[model samples]
Structures are given as C-alpha cells and as structure tokens.
Target: MAPQLDPGDLVVRAQRGEPRAVARLISLVENAGPQLRDVAAALAPHTGRAQVVGLTGSPGVGKSTSTSALVGALRKQGKRVGVLAVDPSSPFSGGALLGDRVRMQEHATDDGVFIRSMATRGHLGGLAWSTPQALRVLDAAGCDVVLIETVGVGQSEIDVVSLADTTIVLLAPGMGDGVQAAKAGILEIADVFVVNKADRDGADQTVRDLKYMISLGDRRSPDGAAWTPPILKTVAARGEGVEDVVAAIDSHRDWIDRSGERDRRRLQRAESEIQAITLEQVRARLGDVGGSAALPELAKRVVAGELDPYRAADELIAAVGSG
Candidate 1:
C-alpha cells in the first residue's frame, strides 16, 4: 500500500491541480483508517468555506445535466465550483459507471471548476463514506461552491439533507404518475424543487402536482416560518431556467443565514459526524475480533431456522467481547 500521505502536503498539491495528489487524498479518505482522524483535524479549519448544495432525483431526471448547468452559472459569476457526483455501485462488481462525468464535460477544462465522481461503495446513507473528507479537500482548495449530486434511490435517499446546506430534488414531466414520485418521500427533504425537462409535455402538470404535494406536507422553513419549497421549471439540456435555479439556491442561503437555521444545520451535521465515527469504531473493533469469520456460520444457522437473527447478533457480540 502507498504509505498514508501527509495531509498538509496532499492539501497543497490538490489545490495546485495535481491530479495524482487529488486522487491519492480522495482514496485515503474514502478508505479511511486511524490516520484519517489526523487528516480531518488538520482539515477542520478549511471546512465551512464552501456552500454545499445537494441535487437528487430518480435516475434519468437530468440531475447531472442540471448540476452541470448550475456549475457553469456559478462559474460565470466568478465563483470557483467543485462538484461531487455520487454514482451507484454494481452489486456484483462493486464498480460504478460514473456516467455523471460524461454529462459534465463542459467544465472538464475550466481551471475554476473541479468535478469528481464518487461511488456509493455500498454505503446505505445518502453520502459516500469519504464525503466529509472530500468536502474538506474542496474547501481547502478554495471552492466557493460545492455541488453534491446524489444517486437518487427514491425514499431512502434522504441522506442528502445531512450532507448539504441546501438540498434540491429534481423531477421531470411525464414520468409515471407524478404522485408516485411524491409518495417516495422525495418531497419531504427538499429545500427547493426543480422540474427539469420543462420543455417536455405535461411539465405544467408535474409542477402543479409537486406544489400540491408540498402544500399537503406541512412545509415550513427551518425557523418555523411558513414557507413552501418553490418549484422551478428547467430545460437543463438547453440551459433554460438554470439562472432561476441558481437564484433559488441563493435565496435559500440568505434564508438560512438570517433565520439561524444555518447554525442549527451545523449542529445537526456535527451530530451526524459523531454517529458515523461511533459506528466506524464499533465496526473496526468487530473486525478485529474475527467477527467476519463467524458471520457465515451464524447466517447459515439463521437460515436453517436453528437460530434467530436477534440471538445470532447477541452471540456475535458475546464472542467479540470475550475475544
């Protein structure tokens, strides 16, 4: 294995556009170990600099295209933007196609723009395992905006709310009953709703359906102010309505700052970090006690009806504690 990088040196080189350095730092963070604590400590001061925005939607909703357009618009305003696109890993191969990269080629050569594609790597939550570390790197590298594009897996995709300052859920026209999408819990977490492919037929119906759903959800701003998540129409392919999307993001940011919700979100994010760290430590200790070796036999016993899953877990815990 490559020796763990010196976090300071990695940050410096990444900011200078050294591809190898950036790749090494990302890999180290993604497959974090004890040394990651040191890296994260060193990176603390660099965080909170980037305005993190998350975009999510069902597959084929033009999330990548919309993100690309949003990045372009931000860059036009003289902002340095970083995009992290999360793609699903194949169950059998554990590899990701990272198709978002293809859609974001417009910014590939822009010095002010940086785009990275990350695999979910079987992480159940909305964020990739290394997301915090990657965000730290981007923040240190002087990005004014960081856009996270999630691998939208419907209701379970609420993880974005924890990872971003603003979360925009994307929708498209003429998708199966629009109500089906709303039922998937996508509406609950949205800071802003986007109706992409607005030029397509039934775009108005999609927007109307989403607004009606929002009304029923008892939506409010983080400060308990009566506010609805605005639904904006967009044609990301042709770059129409992108500016409005950008404006909506700005409006949310202003609201967060003035309403004190920003501080509340920061507190929530800190709590999330604590939980993630606790789980990681527990998992590592379990692995150290050869729990992986016992898993197969325990699973077989459960499948055979000789043991219940709850009992199997208790047994595993006992084995680890005794070992």
Candidate 2:
C-alpha cells in the first residue's frame, strides 16, 4: 500500500503556492483517494478567493490560444493564475488527448502560473468529473484567477456557466458559430463574447450577427439589472485584442458582485456540488447493496414481470439506505 499523506502539510504548502502540493491534492481528488475528504477539509478555509473564468467554444475556435494570451495579460497585472484545460479522453489510454500543457509551454516555467490538462474520461458536459475539486485546490493555492477551458463539445458544454464567475464564448468568422450559439442556448450563459481570428475574412459579419442576436436577448441579472455582454474581436495567435477581453471579464465580475449576483450564483454552485457529492455517496451505497444479492434478486423479479423497474428502484434505494 502507498504511504498515507499528511493533508494538513499539503494544504499549508499549497497555500504558499507550492505547485507540487496543489497538483498532488488535485490528483487525489481526481482519483477519489481515501485522503480526499481530509484534504478538502484542510483546504476549505483558504478557498473562495480566486476568480474563475471559463472559456468554451466549438473546436478550432482558438480557445487554447486565447487562454494563453489571457494568462499573459493577468500575469502582467501581477496576479497568480491557474488553468485547467479539460481535454477529450483518448480511447486507448483514457488520458487527456490534446495535452494542452504542450500548447502552453510558454508559461510552463512561470512560477506564477499553474496549468493542468484533465481528461474528460467519459464524463459529459465538457469537463472532467473532478474539475470543481481541482478548482478548489487552485483557489486555496493562492491563485487570484483560475481559467477553465472546456473540451469544446457542442451544446452540452454549457455546464461551464455553473462554475465560472465569468463565462466567455468564442466564435470564429467562418464556423457558422452564430447559428450554433443560438441553437446551443449559449447566448443565455455567455458573460462575454469573443470573435477570435478577427484577421480572417467574414469577421465583420460575425460581429454584426452576434450584435443582432444580443439585441434580441433579455440580458439581465436576477436583481433586474441589465448586463449587456461585450462582443470583441481578437487574433489570439498574435495576442491582439486579449486585453479588451480581459477588461470585459473584469467588468462582468464587477457587475455580478455589485448586483449581488455573485453571492447568489455561488450559493447555487455550492448546492449543486453538494447534491452531486450526495448522489455519489448514495451510488456507492447502492453498489454495496448490489453486491449483497439484492440487485440480482431485483433483476430476477423484474425479468419475470413480477416487479416493475420503478418498484425495484425504490427497493434498491431502501436496501442501500439500510446497508
């Protein structure tokens, strides 16, 4: 068996901006290690400080490039940054296929930046299953900002809006993203819209299309305050227009905080996190009940048409609760 880790020590080191400690803690979270609960408890007090910004778009929208440029901009302001790039999983090895760290090698040696690429590993909604816990690790590790780049899967990827303080949706000039964005209901979730590769043809029309769409949407906060998302053009490869994007993010953050939407959103995020954890625990309990001959008998009864699936599910929950 592996040696037990000292969660307190790790938490302390991570708060001091020790990358290895932060990475180790995130690894424990990803693997669902026995020490995870202890580590989370140790790090809880230091969290809730980092501003999480999520960048998501369909594939080939320069999300990685934009993320790297934004990191550079934030670092210029002397803020420590963390990036979690969620990549599609490789079918063969179940590892992050894109290895975004390689794409962001420019900041690989920067002490103020911590970049990690996590595989979706069959998890839906364009994120790794442990992303929230990993965000906590970075937040507690003294990062002023944490950027989450999703796997860029269409439609289902809107889950990023739940975790990010500000959500940026990127579109390219020729990708027909304006239509896709509407179909995906992304207009509702986006806090900032970026037209990347602005140097390309049709960039002007893309901007115009986005502007027209935004004009029709009711972009308001729960407090009845309006938040018109700023649409900007960028050539991320050249780092042009990134500063404007960053400014828009800062502006949206201020708006959310001032309107009390930040607190409301965080509360909702916590509720979702709690529900997910509770379900996972219940799932584990159901597994235990399944192994104890309960599941096989239920299956047999259902197969014989003596019991409906819904009744079997109710019985399974009761067995899990008792077990």
Candidate 3:
C-alpha cells in the first residue's frame, strides 16, 4: 500500500522519482477527492514542460504495440517517459479491464519509464475525466515526454485533441482505418498518422488513402496555415519504421515550437481544463445536477401540473445559485 502522503508530500515524492507517490496522486485525482485542488495548485508550477503526445485509434489497430515501440525508441534517446493509458471499464471492479501494463510489459523494469492505466468509467471521447490531472502529476515528476494513449472506442475518441501537444492516430493495414478516420472525425485531430503493421498487404494503399485525405484539408490549423501531416509506415510489432515514426513526431514538435503553436495549444488546453473543472465543481456544489433535492422537488411540482418545466428549470437554477 502507498504511504498516506498528503497532496504536498505526494508532489515532493513524485518530483524525486517516487513512482508510488505518482500513482497515488493519480488515484486521488480519479476519485475526485477534495485533495485534488491542493494537488493541482502544488503541481501547476512544475508542469508546462513535458511534451504530451496522444495516441488514439480504433480497436485492433496496433495502438498498444505502436505505443510500446514508440516508448522504446524514446527511451533510447534517454528521455524520461510517462505513459497514461486509458482502458475500458471493468464491470465488477470499475477499473481498467485490459490493463495497459500487460500490453507494455517490456518496459516494466525500466526506471526511465512510468506507466499507469486508468479506467474510462463510461466517459465519452475515450478519456478519463481526470486525465489532465494525472498528466500534471507525470509532468511534475520530470518526465520529458508523456504519452496519453486513449481507449480505442472508434470515432468518438476526439478528447485527446484538447489534451495532447502532438496527437498520433494509429491504424493497421486493411483495417479501413483511413475510411474510419474520416468518418470518426479523427482526420481533424491527427497531428501525425502512422500506418502500423506496414509489412502487411494494403499498407501502401492505406498510406495513399491518408495522403488523399490530408490533401483534401482534413486537418485543421487555427491560423489557417497548413501543416501537411506525414503518413509514415511502421511495423510496430517488429520495431521496423518505429524510428521514422519518432522522427516524424520530433519534426512535428519542432514545427509547433517554432511556429508558436505549442504555446497556443497549451493555452487552449488550459482553458478547456479550467472549464471542465469549473463544470465539475458546479455539479458537486449542486449535488449531482439532475439528482439534486431541488431537482426532484421541481419534478414533483411539474408532474402535479403545478409548475411548468421551464419555470421549474428557473427554480432549479436559483437553487443552484444559492447553493
């Protein structure tokens, strides 16, 4: 069991490379305990340095393999890496079902790497609600790079876009990843596209398809300036072309840094994080929004034909404001 470290102690231990403390901090975030605000305050100054990359795609698209291979490549460069993998919820435990640790067993003994699995717990966009908080923990822990691999829940996995500096959309050959990417709105979010399992048939076609999509302006730039995303082929299973993928990622990072896009992205990320936190706080104060005592009473009034729903909403809003 992790020692009972308070928010301050946890931050200090994590900064000193104590993985247990880091994991515990993330656990506190996931549980949405009161300590989180204090933890966030303590972590705020130490963050804003780690290069957070997001990995997302449909299931069976070699996402985990590509992630492990990328980690190996990143480690070879002597980078301290943190991996936050979001997994599907387990029915009974409400924890990560396919535990990412099992897929990334190769790095279990590596001191330079830290991996944690989080259950999505039915949150949409394939991200756990506490992801950004967990990210801050890893960033403050001095990880030079942090990879956020989200749940592969097909097209709705766009939440990573707001959380990562560089988002990699992985797809295997013959999986219709290209077609699915467009349909699922991934085309708008990917910073780098990786055709994993490149040795398989239709790999070239997949690359071509992505190129065609990119040429059609499937990607977005807030400045209206274009960034032609590189479509790299990789055999992540065998480590082939993994370096090229890393090189592409590095290239994108460098571009973002030079083009002043990195800061902009972080600013947007902060805005979104703050907005989400505010909404969560408001809900907590209002006692779960829809399940509040005021809400049920208003429901009763509405059902009894004594008050209209619109008026009830006004009353509920007043109650929330008072609370």
Residue 15 deviation, candidate 2, in Å? 0.7
What tens digits encode model 3's per-residue C-alpha lDDT throughout 280-321?
667676676566567788888999999999999787777777
Per-residue error for 106 in candidate 2, Å, reads 2.0
The better-scoring model by lDDT among 1 and 3 is: 3
> On residues 180-266, what C-alpha lDDT tens digit does candidate 2 reach at each position?
888887877889999999999999999999999999988667879999999999999789999999899999999999998888889
Better of 1 and 2 by lDDT: 2
Candidate 1 structure quality by residue, lDDT tens digits, 1-323 = 77767888887787776756666666667667666777777667767878989888876788777888898899999999887777453111123335545555558778788777665555564253577678777877778998887755643345554578888888889985356566666666788989899999999999888877777788555668654688999999789999999999999998888888777887888787788777766676677654567877888899999999999989878876676
RMSD of 3: 3.7
Flag regions of model 3 displaced more than 4 Å: 1-3, 88-103, 122-126, 151-156, 218-224, 288-308
Scored by lDDT, the top model is 2
Off by over 4 Å in 1: 1-4, 15-20, 89-103, 122-128, 154-156, 289-323
Please give the range of 10 consecutive residues that has the lowest summed lDDT in model 3.
88-97
Each model's lDDT comes to 0.75, 0.83, 0.79
* TM-score between model 3 and native: 0.86
Error of 3 at 214 (Å): 1.1
Work out the TM-score per prediction.
0.81, 0.89, 0.86
